[model samples]
Target: MNPTELLSLLALKKAPLVGDILAKKLIREFGSASAVFEQDKPSIAALEGMGDKKASFIENKTFLFKKAEKELEFIEKHRIKYRVYYNDDYSKRLQYCPDGPIIYFEKGKIELDNPYVLSIVGTRQITTNAAAFLEKFISEIAPLNPIIVSGYAYGVDILAHKLAIENKLQTVAVLAHGLNQTYPRNHEAYNEQMMENGGFISDFWHSDSFDRKNFLGRNRIIAGLSEATVVIESASKGGSLVTADLASDYNREVFAVPGRVNDKYSIGCNELIKQAKAHMLTKTEDIAYILGWEKKQDIAIQKQLFVELNDEEKQVFKYLKKADKELLDIIAMDLQMPVHKVASMLMGMELKGVVKPLPGKLFTLA
Candidate 1:
């Protein structure tokens, strides 16, 4: 987009009583952001949903344009990049969502062309087991070269972003604030490296400050930009669950990791599964299977199988490897290990993508 048109879009964003939905309506009616600005008051009011007050706001463009000019200066000085909703560079998945941002500012080289995009979200207070699962999950999916999207906050969100980087997969951080600064100040450490492969995206301008309510808007981008949203962990009420709901609203698949019934953080995910709102995700391959994503190449399953395992895990791994499928109790009794111990080992191996649990307590090598 040219400078004039970009400025007009910015001004349109700043206009009072005109949000993404209304702005989109105006853009469609006038053909372009610039054309919307050129229309007379009567022309603006004549359009559906436009009243005298909104028409006056569109007519009085000096204040909004001034603000847009300042934003333009910041964009130019910082070398920030932006994608207009109607442009080819915009996110294809997001384009289908009518309420997606009309324009969003970005910094760094974010490759949106990747066919497999998954948004990972969860509770801010992550558990050790959840962290381990994410590590193994990222490792398993790394072979698909999927683009990972997250809110860039602490816990599951940041963990997802960090793991994506570690695995050399492109990751996008959808921020609740503007590009001027990272929220939670301490996370600034990951900014440089994130921009190296993925980048930060935000609909807010440099002038916008961090706000609690901004998360609802941010979550939509997290949901709309991906083919699926994965919730590693979440409490009964939190932003991650909100993203899952939004993803469902967008008709995208939502998956949640199951946790023990009484676990506090697992309530949301378990509820999702019980309510039929999300698929019960146990392993990385479940994602590929449900989404019909063929493995692009071997995902190092053999390498993971050989990974250092405790004596008990080794015994169970050996037993499961030789058999097509075995009952959990049979393995425990045959190996002379406690049923609980075998169950625990199976869970660990499942996270490692070395074992998969089938119905009726059956276990098999993944």
Candidate 2:
């Protein structure tokens, strides 16, 4: 590893001493870390927050450059690439955050381009309606060629990626851990797919473990990198709302897709819309109108807005739009179309970008 790379590893791998707060103070006083490491015990003892015992211990602590050799070897063996905060390729958005990660690791290619990037965030416990609605949302915007970014968690984040993948759109996942590892083991498949299709990014250097503080900071980056944030569904207080609040503070558009007023999971989203902190999106047209994307999508399609037809399709659309429920019985009773015929019609609607069929025979309108 180069001297800078070696320095970064040494800095992060060391046990937390000074909270990030004290470390900044210490860094400014010492100038370069090398100069700090070279200081005599007595001189270190004179520094602020450095009582005789702490100064003597930390000043003399073995911060030998070789201590990072093993970590360097491990990452090299796995072919991982890393970067420092000042490096050109570092995430431009994250770099602006206060005390952003000192370094980062990358698993795939990504772009910091465009005047527009939007985050798709929500709760991990998602409903079929939420999933299907997100699918249509992505489809409408795919033609406009905007970048989609999200945290690589379950629920809304996964739905965003799944829809982005199906439409062959560019996406990225901002994680809270080192790129060398993932927090949720179950997202292994999703991670691989993202690396191949978009990218997985993080502020932690290799060997860094997941930390609660790290995730809160991670939300800041998600909010910073995008032009706006959309919360599909969230609890009263959770990571999604944190990102939305940050987006609002950053002077970016914040949109929310409201659910049934009584839904506990969607209460936060409803509140955001109600409080006028977020724009309510009944269709992708809401976002499109905000971005002036009519010039981008098919003019005819864009100009018409997303119309909810009031025919037989409307009856079916209304039912699915409300939520995804098993339809074999409902179709037979409500639509009065034969079960087989209704099934065929539903499939047609799915192809037409009007609905989505979830696992286990459930369906929702997209």
Candidate 3:
């Protein structure tokens, strides 16, 4: 984008109470960010969701525009690349998000055309088991050549980035702060390697101070960039869970690796499964199956067909084969089996590689 247009966007970003949604609205209505700033107060306030209070902020050109100028100078000096929301290079999945940033800075060679992208996130206090699971999971998915997205923070986020590097798959780190400096300081070790394939991205300005609250904004980018978000491990509450929720809000698939009930980090994953917010992820194949990453011919139906199924399990399987998919309750009702019994039967069948569970309590033949 030209400096004039970029400066306008930076100014829009600086406006108080003028978030991404509102800024984009103004831009769409005015035809350009520069035009949005040209509108009179009466014109700006005339739009829905805008009023005197909001208009005042947008009209604060004396302060907001000056800041934008300084930020633009920094961008030029650092030679950073930014993706405008309407640009072709912007994240395709993220562009559809209503609250996606109008522009975000990126460092490194990031290719958005990759067919598969997944975000792995979790608590900073990652457990040994979670780390082991991530290693094996990344290895299994390496053949698919998927892009990995994550926060560059410690624990699962850093682990996900490093694992993607080790597997030779591109990895993108969504930062909570600007590219002016790396947070945590210690992670500078991986910066050179990350830039080779994936790289760092953020919407924060060079002058923006790092804060705890920034993660919420950063997490949205991670969630928005991928077709699916996986919660490797999280406590009952954390930024990872927030990312999972954002992914669900975007109508993207979410998967969580289950841990023992009492495991602190497992609490979030179990709750997501129990609440039906995420599909239960047990093995790497679960992701492939749910995402339909595998071609029909690759599924070895012969092996599954030969796997013996009990009478009730066979009944469910037959119905599922005829129908594309079915809900858990519907299967129970149609088969005249108790819901609990059907649930148990389905679990056993899933283990036998004859059934697969989907989000929203749905099931399908594996």
* Residues 64-132, model 1: lDDT tens digits: 899999999999999999989999999999999988999999998898988999999999999999999
Whole-model lDDT per candidate: 0.89, 0.71, 0.89
**For residue 17, what is the lDDT in candidate 3?**
82
Which segments of candidate 3 are over 4 A away from where they belong? 296-366
Question: lDDT order of candidates, best first?
Answer: 1, 3, 2
Query: Model 2, clash count?
Result: 0
Give the Å shift of residue 232 in candidate 3: 0.7
Question: What count of clashes does model 1 give?
Answer: 0
Question: Number of backbone collisions per candidate, in order?
Answer: 0, 0, 0
lDDT, model 1: 0.89
User: How far in Å is the alpha carbon of 289 misplaced in model 2?
Assistant: 3.7
* Model 1 misplaced regions, further than 4 Å: 295-366
- What lDDT is reached at residue 251 by model 3? 97
The CA lDDT at 366 in model 2 is 54
What is the per-residue lDDT of model 2 for residues 6-87, given as tens digits with 9 covering 90 to 100?
A: 5644553352444333444455677645555666767766878765765544543455344556566766787766755556
Question: Which portions of model 2 show Cα errors greater than 4 Å?
Answer: 9-67, 210-214, 291-366
